[model samples]
Target: MGSLIFFTVSASAPMTVLAGGVVTTYAVTGSIGVPLSFPILGVALALFTVGYAAMTRYVENAGAFYAYIALGLSRAWGVAGSAVAIVAYNTIQIGLYGLFGWAFSGFAAAHWQADLPWWACALGVWAIVGLLGLFNVDLSAKVLGFFLIAEIIAVLLFDIGGFGHPAGGSVSTESLAPGSLFTSGVGGVFAFGIAAFVGFESAAVYSGEVKDPRRTVARATYVAVAITSVLYAVSAWALASASGKDGLAAGPADPFGMIGQWFGTGLSTAANVLFLTSVFAALLSFHMVVSRYTFAAGQEGVLPRFTAATWRRTGSPVAGSLLQSLAGVVTFAIFAMLGRDPLLELFTWLSYVAAVGVLVLMIGTSVSVLGYFARRDSVESVWQRIIAPGLAAIALIAITATVVVNADSILGAEKGSVLTYVLPGIVAAAVVIGLLWGYTIKLTRPSVYAGIGEGGARQAAALAGIEDLLAQDERIPA
Candidate 1:
């Protein structure tokens, strides 16, 4: 649970937001409500978790969104959801490679005066991540935990520095006001705030590797959410307080710049350093998530079984890890050959897809939660199994709609750009294909189809042609 919480928090990449997202949201919305939305979105996720955490108890595979969707919706939807999830996870993970390549190269160029290409930096970390991905998940978790603590400390220290010396010589409560979120660009605020919470849901993906998954998953998930929420809000609030009225307008253009100018060179340097590690942390977090999704999909016979096979000693998904690593190499090469701007093209497109994809996954999971318990009454109260998830589903649906309506604003694209329509269209198509794929499974393979969300146990049994044994009484009646 501790390690999972670390991975979850690292995935949030608090410093990255403080340095970029918070200021960007402030700049876009022209409203200080960006900080407030953290808590609002956190609450929505909390309600969503009420059902999500419960569903984890019964889901067979720790496929995270895929398992839940398969069990709650249908096996086909699970497969489709798995496709969308793999795309989404890869989308974000790939984008991070772009960001990582760009940031690291830029850093080396500026400080060390090394004229290296961004792709080189990208492939370098790709090697590190790919190598690490092949090992035990616990190792990754420990590294993430260290990065999480260091980054958090860096942000907190900066916050203290900001509070110590206000940007405009006086603190302002305008940002903390509730009405501020209802202002001009609240939808954009909702859109971006939700994006920051992307990898928090992925803790459940590690269920198969964790101890006492039911309790561990729940504990890590809730704590990850709570800590991510508070850290973002507090850090943003402090930064806003330091920036005051004037700096608020200038904040977005150069967030770290404002910090350096306000705080000092030393802390600013630290923030910059932490900024790189935070993004790296995010990269690894997403890498683990993407690989796990691929691993689970492979296990379900949706993909080649070899890809989902685990390393006996480390308990890591070796095949999926290698495949993801190979994909990263090919992608980085494509970007390099094309000579494209990593951040503007690769990161921009992929990040948008990932952010929206996670929202879509949650919407599916919310409904799946309701479906999971409704068909059976052997569980807890109606509130937990039914009403809570139902409310969550509705809330997520609304959130998804808000984001879609405000997509152009959020992506900073022209009102009806081809890019704008295409990104979302991809996910919608994936869902449709997934639904059909599932229905086909129902027709062709009854046994595997029947084991869709039973924790992969039934599916494994079915694949071994022992599904009948799974249902047979094992009692040695004497």
Candidate 2:
């Protein structure tokens, strides 16, 4: 349970979210109401988990969204969901390299007077992540746990300092007002707020690896959501309290540096160092997630059988890890060679795309939960089966629509830029390809298709079928 929550919350990258995401969101949307979005998003997610956690008791697969959607909806949509998930997870993982490189390079130049290219620093972290992915997953979890704790401590200290020294010698709750989110640029606030919780839903992805899947997954999911929500909301409000909403909108050159003045250079330097670790931890966590998803798809025959290969000694997904490493190398090389702005193009654009992909999956998963329980006659309550998921579906629909409508602001682009269509089109293409591939498999491979979403149940069913066929053949004297 501890490591599960660690891996899940580490995906949110606490230090990075505070230093980069929250600060930029303030500047971009000019909405101090950003603090209000976290709780709102949290409520929707809690409703989502009401059904999601219940569904996990019945299905156990690493490709959680794929399995849930497949079982509840159809095998074809499951494949499609998995395809988009691969794209989303990979983009978020690889995209962090840009931020990692940019932050590390800047820190090196400033602190040590040593110059380094962002790509060079990025590749250094990339190599380390690739190496770690080959080892046991427990090792990766430990690493994430260490970094997550350190970053959270640093963020809490910063928040305390910010509150200790309020802008006008008194605390302000202007940002925490629910009505703040209803104003202009509300979509941008929701978009950025939800993006901060990117890794919370990842708890169920590790269901197959945990000790007690039923309790551990549910508990971890709820705890991760609660931790991130309280931390982000408090930190955002603290920053506003320290800098004031008006000053934050004026856009200080460096929010961290500004807040650092309230304390001293020592804490400021520590925050910068932890910021690098935060990004690396998120990179490793997402790498594990993507690899596991690939592994599950292979086990279920959605992808090539070779992808299911795992190291016997450590239970690490070998082929899947290598695939993710190759993806990271290729993406980094492309951005490096093109001489593009690493922060703006790589991190910002890819993060936005990942956010959109996740929102789409959440919507699908919420509806699939309803579809799943509707077909079952279990002892679960009506809220778990229907009410929660129904309301979740509606909330998610509204949230996703709002985010998509204001994509221009989220991406920091002109209103009619080609990216508004092209970036999202990437996810759209994955969905289409998945649907077509799933249909092809159903037509050509009936045996493999029979176990699409049955998870462990599918293997038992196949073995039983084989025994029955053998018995019938023997009785015929063949």
lDDT of 2 at 386: 91
Per-residue C-alpha lDDT of model 2 across residues 12-99, encoded as one tens digit per residue: 8889888767876776767778887888898899888878887877776644688888888988898899998999989988888998
Best-matching candidate per lDDT: 2
Q: Relative to the unseen true structure, what is the C-alpha lDDT of residue 368 in candidate 2, on a scale of 0 to 100?
A: 94
The TM-scores, one per candidate, come to 0.86, 0.88
Error of 1 at 136 (Å): 5.1
RMSD of each: 3.9, 4.0
Candidate models: Cα lDDT each: 0.75, 0.80
Residues 1-478, candidate 1: write the lDDT tens digits.
Answer: 8878877787778887776567666765567767788988888898888778777667655546877888787778888888788888887788778877877887787678999899999999998888788884434556666766778888888777667767677766777788977764666677668767887876776777877776788788889999999989887788778777667776354445556776677766777888888877677767887787777677776777787788887889888888888887897789889987776567655666776788888888989888878788755677778887888888878877776676665556777787668887878888888778878878987665666655666556655777567767353111
Q: Which stretches of candidate 2 lie over 4 Å from their true place?
A: 1-7, 136-143, 168-172, 178-180, 205-216, 250-255, 309-315, 456-478
Residue 32 of candidate 1: its Cα lDDT? 77
Q: Model 1 Cα RMSD, Å? A: 3.9
Counting clashing residue pairs in each candidate, in order, gives 3, 0
